[model samples]
Target: MDGRAARETPVHLRLTHRGRVVFGTIGTLLTAGVLALLAALGATSASASAEQSEQSFSTVVAAPGDSLWGIAESLDPEGDPRDLVAELVTLNGMDGSGVQAGESIAVPTRYADAPGVIPAQ
Candidate 1:
């Protein structure tokens, strides 16, 4: 080939041993970082569910003409109904304070035993 043709030809790129080692290490680190992040996310969700499952619930069937205020009061006569009502809403994933007759709802075991009173931990 002429010198001019040789000059125009593309040179193939090559990596030295050190360059290969560096690239390999960088790839491995990125992979490990992604796996670790995923693992942490999984563990967080698992722990949250575990915490929720640890708390036991009691089923209370709604009687005719029953209201959330009434139920909260019945659960704890001496304690504020608002707190219990809020808890019940959260427990049942209710949109509002409405309760239908004969509908079963979950009540925390602790609240059923003693209305408005949480025993010392």
Candidate 2:
């Protein structure tokens, strides 16, 4: 052999017997990892979107002879009755100025009207 060795092909372009097979395997693995990452991101966004569409509220309906004002007054006694009224209206699809007995309404969280709590939009 001469003092200088033969110049071999570059690693990426080499076509040795095992080079092609190994390179193909590595390429496939990298591609799979990238695709998996994309799939995870897509799933996360879809779940978040579904979450935004659905919301839950809690309220109790009044029995016959019970007054709307009384129900409003009694809900979350520690919370702001006004905000409770708003959440109730928004949740039950009731008229802003009207309420009736036997109607279910959502009560705002106790924290909703508590001091130092940020008001809901």
Candidate 3:
């Protein structure tokens, strides 16, 4: 027989105290690293937040040919022009009745912001 064991390295089972200690330490380190990574991600998400934007609006008056429907279509297409009677009534110093020809009013501009908010002279 040669000086080598037959059933040696073929199915080598590391059953020694030192081997078990090394494997346990490796497993503990891996678990600790994964836990730390999860903790860091949680902390980052908790600290994250969103921002808010402030908005303002304005409009022009109606002319001889322009109707409330036309003004609403040009300014606030999402809203009904008839509904805008409230705003128009408030702005152009008009009654709940209606508007006249050659009369200008503030049309709500939802498509974008007022270029420069200012008062009429």
Candidate 4:
């Protein structure tokens, strides 16, 4: 063997211990960052679905003298009752503002136990 061949190291075997440690640490950090980002994305999607499920509708029984306007006012006091009544009409597939007593109807509600609200019979 020539002395020149003995003096020169192969390119594939050029990394030192410190270089290997640095590369390993960098790779670990990159993996951890990617995992954290994926977890955050997953959490956001989960919360979005949870929120969508939370804003669901509720069933209510129409009482005597309970018009769509009155039901809408009781269910969503903070909102425009006319709009809510219109939505109720469309949701129940009603031809007009007429609602019979003891009839089941769907109403938009944010809480399961809403005050002054009658449940579906």
Per-residue lDDT over 1-121 for candidate 4, one digit per residue giving the tens place of the 0 to 100 score: 6789878976776889999999999999999999999999999999997896565466878889888888888777898988988888887678998889998877755534677555543
Better model by TM-score: candidate 1 vs candidate 2: 1
**Ranked candidates, highest TM-score first:** 1, 4, 2, 3
The order by descending lDDT is 1, 4, 2, 3
Could you tell me the lDDT of residue 39 within candidate 1?
A: 100
Where does candidate 2 clash, by residue pair?
none
lDDT of each: 0.83, 0.63, 0.60, 0.80
Best by lDDT: 1
Query: How does residue 32 of candidate 1 score in lDDT?
Result: 100
Candidate 3 segments whose C-alpha is farther than 4 A from its true place? 1-59, 107-121
With a 3 Å backbone cut-off (N, CA, C), the pairs that clash in candidate 3 are 59-107, 60-105, 60-107, 61-104, 61-105, 62-104, 62-105
In model 4, the clashing pairs are none
Q: Of the pair 1 and 4, which is ahead by TM-score?
A: 1
Count of clashing residue pairs in every prediction: 1, 0, 7, 0
| lDDT for each residue of candidate 1 in 71-97, tens digit (9 for 90 to 100) | 888888889999989999998889999
Considering lDDT, which of the candidate structures 2 and 3 is the better prediction for this target? 2
The best candidate in terms of TM-score: 1
Task: Please write out the lDDT profile of model 2 over residues 2-119, one tens digit for every residue.
Answer: 7546776555654887988898999999999999999999999999967953554344556667554556666556656676567666756676636566565554555345432334
TM-score of each: 0.56, 0.36, 0.34, 0.46
Candidate 4 C-alpha RMSD relative to the actual structure? 10.7
lDDT tens digits, residues 35-95, model 3? 9999999877666622111223354545677665666555555778677666656645566
